[model samples]
Target chain A: MKKIISVLLAAAMAFALAACGGAQSSAPASSAPAASSAAPGQSSSVAAYATSLDDIKVKGELVIGLDDTFAPMGFRDENGDLVGFDIDLATAVCEVLGVKPVFQPIDWDAKELELSTGKIDCIWNGMSITPEREQSMSLSNAYLNNKIIIMTNKGVTIASKDDLANYNLGTQADSSALEVVKGDPIYDSIKDKLTEYKTYDQVIMDMQAGRIDAMIVDEVLGQYKNTQLGNVFEVAPVDFGEDLYAIGLRKSDTELTDAINAAMKTCIDSGTAAEISTKWFGSDIMVK
Target chain B: MNLSYIATLMPALMQGLAQTLKLFALTLIFSLPLGLVFTLGSISRVPPLRWVSRIYIWIFRGTPLMLQLFFIYYGLPFMGLTFDRFPAAVLTFVLNYAAYFAEIYRAGIQSIDRGQHEAAKTLGFTPWQTMRYIIIPQTVSRVIPPVCNETITLVKDTALVTAIGVGELLKAAQGAVNRDVNITAYAVAALIYLAITFVMTMAYERLERYFSRHQKKEG
Candidate 1:
């Protein structure tokens, strides 16, 4: 009886392991579309979007991926509708091309996946175009040059980045700021001192509760929260040096890239981009 | 299939397995005694104690562990009492499995023959001594199989702790998947879990045999 039960137990465990293995190995390949196939007869059809950019029209609507959590850039307003700077800029770019703008809220970590799988035509959130990312996608001229800033509760001052050493610094998981901190030459000096949280709000709450010493976030987002959240937190004077946010298109699709660049140029030349930027940001943020 | 990938992740997954073991060990350490207390309450002559214990055991056992875990992790933050992921996970597992252990204890306690109680009463032995000397010895034997079953279930159920981002084995596997955009790492994680379960099954069989052998010698 014991032998039979043992055999049964072994068999059950094997089956469970196999089932999990199957789920893990099979799902990724099936979820992605073929890398370079163009679809028939849709100006911005799935095929045109997938393969060559030349087959796509400049006038058809292009989908952009944005996360609606990071404030001032792209986030839900008080009415729970997606509203922010990215939305305004995307709307202006669409008007230039005589097409509608479609917004897709993407998971931050899966932003590359969304682009590769043809889920969206571009990533237009506060997406930092890193050199490593340059290998995966064709990128446009940068629109907004920004830097990350560290903020803390009022009356607490950090003199410099060196001063931030040994303090509990928080940033959103999978964020470029986290990558910069984790991969920096100075990371070894303070790597043990850092903590990553799932959301920015959690980091802010920890700062309020005196759990973390400070948090690093996009400068605009830090400024927006200082104005809006009605909290006692204030931004530090020192800023991390500038980085750029660009429009990302699949590497295989240059035609879509050309179309977007042309459309964006029209938006810039006609001052439509600046108008939209001022509406959202209270200043013209169109960069050279 | 991806032996190389599994080899790469083995160290991280081992750390996660350590956490899984800690949760299992600590929950059992606390819940086993709490379960016996619950058993005592359910069998208590005091009507209110009996009713309250019965309701607790019924509710914890009746509901699913997954739902209870979510309630502890997601629901508590709204009430202004937030627990970090690890503590919330351990608390959920302890509360949930303690109820199952309680039922096993109740059944074992009840299996003590009514005659033993009546006999002790006739001999002028106090109720407490009768329970310690007569009921406990007999109940211990019947409780072993159920305890073993609960312990095994608790091992696999540790994976649910990942839903709250506690970074146990399953979430470690998931984090690997998110990075590589491949799922095979999760399958490897399953095999690791199977290995642990296999060792535990062997140990449990050995224990059952040892106890059975001692019983036969006494008989």
Candidate 2:
């Protein structure tokens, strides 16, 4: 009987992985286009703009879209298990909302389309707030604080933002860091030296290999990478200003926007958010 | 480069390789026969059948495989059609490869001497018999080398499945790199891919020699 139970558990995990986050009761974080009890076409086509709390309740699950490759946020761990700060926080929020949280891994580039088309009800990843995002999507109130900071290989010194002019710099294209840097006067000083990669991982890799002298990245991801790589790089003395992380929902889903924000408030008030945050990041990083 | 870190990654890498091998094997099984059907369609006397096959070949072959994957997996959902991740990936790969295979088979068919057809006709054999006995067998041997090239390309193309969020060998390696913040996993992945292709190439060479042996003896 024990052997059978273990086999069943294994089967469930494999199904969760294969279905791309199908509803596996055990691992609340299932993988991609989960055939949710919600009738896909009926929900999107018939209602059009009525993705309210009731509709999600009828479906009985919150289909969250995320880029699974993002570490320290919604990424897989060393054991190939999906566990991160956002994943745990979302799970807590889902418990409060009384629905299972189904994590659907998505192409990060197409996240907005995924939201607009009703494929996923929300983008619950560690997405940062930017002017364009605020303009395009209905967003929750700030849940966590982050900063876009410059980091450099240990031997490379950058005493200030201007000191970056002496070194080769890199940041992810289309990332909030790039947005912040571009808007800063210092951007002009480092424009010739700046290179943009598709992901921070590549920048980290290049820095470890000694090709890039410095890279601009967010606090959670950059610090996580530094810790994992055994402090290959140190935070440069200068950084872009503070940034906030929030949940992204479709513009018409104002009802869900309010519901999620309320649930988040509940999670914060009860100290559950702090507990989960501490578990992942070693402290309460959630904005009180 | 920690030997221990790569050891820790083995289970996940093996799982990813299983997904890649499944996609590669299923694509070949479906596309090879599907290509023959398309080859027959393109050569049909009816213009509609020939045009349909030609256009399909043109569209699937001319467009990028990654685009087709996105269209089927993500794009089609908006239109009320949805597929699971693995099937969507397999569907895209099979259609894309079949088109390429169809063209290769068509070329092989056309390359046969017209004199052989005339000889088969003179011997009272029907056109169907001529194609079945005289054309296809010879074409199979002729197309093996090109087909092997496509197979090797298909092995690498499995990496594109990651775009649609399906885990495969390359994604596994990238996952490890992100988790460990190290590049050693990538070097190990490259070596594993090289090992797979090396085995596949040697197998294809053996199959090729077996198919073309008679021609070699004559030469």
Candidate 3:
């Protein structure tokens, strides 16, 4: 026992030495200034970030935060490479900005902190335009339109939003679809049946497992999943409402926000955005 | 069940396993010795050392590990100190596990018969020598089973690193499941975790045997 303890003590000393060298060398110098400097009681600093292309040019990369599980917008492929419309669009935008795009997969719950702490420059996934979001972050021009689509398991009945109350419903919590569903006139009727899961994929799984008879999801994701799943889920005839997808930037990042919007507009005009949109959605769904 | 699908996922899952193993290994390396220091501090005769160690253990063990991860990773930035995500995760885990291990060690050490210490003193064994040569050696054999239990828990607890965006194995499986719209990746991840814990269980068994064999000889 003493021999093993002595050996482990020796190894621990060695590990401590190696960790300081290897770990420090691997982390980027630019990412180290991640402190928010917000006073303890306050949530965030109100000081404007005085950065334009110069700071980004110096850093040489734009770290964009996103929830990588979102499909058709930004999600990993089978090879675990990031794909989907938003990623392609971001890559193109980064080409225009003369900086590399570094996609940082983040916890969706921590997106705002990621931006405020300078961990990521912006949230570039399929973020929906909401009043609360617009108040918190400077939103870019709405690039894509999404609808809250209701999907039910096969061999289920009826039509329209009224019939939705008859079946147990599910959706990802904190989703744009959930926001729309909660505000819908029929939500009062279906409120008892709605089950909010952590992700749309989980909601789809529950629908498949027969735990949930139907799932409310974003149209882009629903269409993508329906195509992929192949005859598993049926989209209800009634669409809940529309949601506009936009880029979310820290409120202080007005210059960066303008840069992204200008780049997006250029992509839409030059047919690049349409090309990527067509590839992902089978049509040009860009908000041109 | 689908061999081809599992094959497609192997590379990503293996990448994630590498990350899990790194965290698990690092936490074990740091926590084991650090835990011993706390155990000693917690059980010491000195008033200040014991109280400080007891307080450290109380704060860490009393709070949820997830909350600690959050405060360290997200909250600490307010005070101008910061750690990158993986480092923050490793720090939280090391600190949290060290507290638990301290308690476990304290229990094992205190359980030893007090007569041994008195005998060591009679033989001119200083306090340090009495602990080093008599008390600690005996506690080692007794502590093995509980330490094994804690070590096994650490294997599964690595999954919680996903909360801090560390991309451990379960998160990797989740990414695959989200992309493919299938549950197969989850099943594969479960098997992988089981395999790790199974190996750990076997190693601990061998360790227990080796110690007990020596323990019997000493007896």
Candidate 4:
């Protein structure tokens, strides 16, 4: 009886191993159909986009990717529900396109890969338009005017960019704000004292603790965080030039890009965009 | 593959390595002694002490260390306790590792022969003296292999602190990759890790040999 039980245990282990192997081998087989189905579209240069407007419509959902920690744009509220300016705008855009809006929170750093892999139909977050991004992704026309600004704890004072040389600064890594800071001529003097955090939230925390004297951040995000946190931060007047925020889609998704641009223009022109903007920012800051 | 590019990355990667080594060293220093205390507590005659030790081991061992780091660094601020990044990372590492090391120590202690305890008792050795002279010395040798395994794991696990933006070796490699859009920095980081583990393996082998020197030689 003991021998029989041992044999049965061995067989069970073998069966489990075989089952895992079968599942592993079948994963690629499952994706094979989707690739084969896209072969015809692949041959036609016109339908070369991994996903198209018609495809998204047929699917009945537009998966909009964003970093949910970014406030006033696409972030979670106190109740853990996603609510922000971009959240409202994307929903409106999806409404115009006649598809359900699906917000997929993604690692902000991996947003490009998310778009390329078709994990997200588009990045509709307050993504700043940059040359590097322009080369990689098909971007909609500028929808929001943004600027990188210096923010400090309420008592901390900084008058100009040159004054930044004296303070220990923080900025989010892989961010456009960091890019602007690094590009600035003053960066060389203060570069040694700069800390790159994973998110603006951490930067704000460090600022509150007096670990970092100031944070270089997007105007929209900095204002939102400052207001949300009971105005514990003071915005420095030092500007890092204008940065335009736009929607990012896969490079091949030209038709979808056009569709989104048109939809965005309609949102701006119809006063619906202004109403949404007013609801979030207390003013209609939507691009005319 | 570009030599100049690799050279440019070396400084940042070395800085990251320095941070990783600091974390590994500090964790080992604090966790090893604390682990011994925990092992003793878990085996104590007192129910409350044993239960506390057991529950700590259960919680730390069962949950992911990443969550602990997040809780200590991020979540704690909500309840009025806050720690800076490096301290929080080190504190979390020390706590998490002590639980693991405690289990290893317990296993090592329990594996000692019953005859040794009996002999020690017969020789007028008190419980404390028996543990100090006979049990612990033997347990050290028995535990070295598992302890070495855990030490190597600790070296790799230092990368998880990057979740809290501590910027250790792996995060530095990722930063380099992001900056240059090349993967060569990762290869460099991998080699650095390999060098560390290789040295650790050699050291542990020597330790094993040193510990087993008194064992009867095989013909």
Top candidate (TM-score): 3
Which segments of model 3 are wrong by more than 4 Å?
A: A1-43, A46-51, B217-219
Docking class of 3: incorrect
Clash list (residue pairs), candidate 3: none
The 10-residue segment with the lowest total lDDT in model 2 chain B:
B70-79
| Candidate 3 structure quality by residue, lDDT tens digits, A1-288 | 976875576456546644653343222221222221112211236243335667898999998898887777787776779988899999999998889999998888667667766678889999888766777677899999788888889877649888987888898877788878877788899999999888888888788889889888888888788888886888778888888999988776788889888988888899999999889888888898
lDDT of 1 by residue, A1-288 (tens): 976875576456556655654454332222222111221221222333374433334535667776655566776433335677888887887776667888775545545545654557788887776765566677887888677778887767887777778587788766667666665666687667778887676676677689888888877666666665575677777767666778877776777677778878888888878887788678876775
Question: Residue A110 CA error for candidate 2 (Å)?
Answer: 2.3
Query: Among all windows of ten consecutive residues in candidate 2 chain A, which has the lowest summed lDDT?
Result: A22-31
Task: Give the range of the ten consecutive residues with the poorest summed lDDT in model 4 chain B.
Answer: B174-183
Q: What's the TM for chain B in candidate 1?
A: 0.89
Model 4, residue A189: distance off in Å is 2.0
| DockQ of candidate 2, scored on C-alphas against the true complex (2 decimals) | 0.16
Which 10 consecutive residues of model 1 chain A have the lowest summed lDDT? A31-40
TM-score of each predicted structure versus truth: 0.51, 0.87, 0.90, 0.52
- Per-residue CA lDDT of model 1 for B36-100, tens digit only, reads 88888888877557656766776677657765665565444434455766788888888888888
- What digit string (tens of lDDT, one per residue) describes model 3 on residues B1-219? 799989999988998999999999999999988999999998887755776687678768876787677777766665577899999999999999999999999998999999988998999999999989888888888889999999899989999888667887898899888888888999999999999999999999999998789767868
| Model 4 stretches astray by more than 4 angstroms | A1-49, B1-219
Ranking by lDDT: 2, 3, 4, 1
Give the clash count for each candidate. Answer: 5, 5, 0, 0
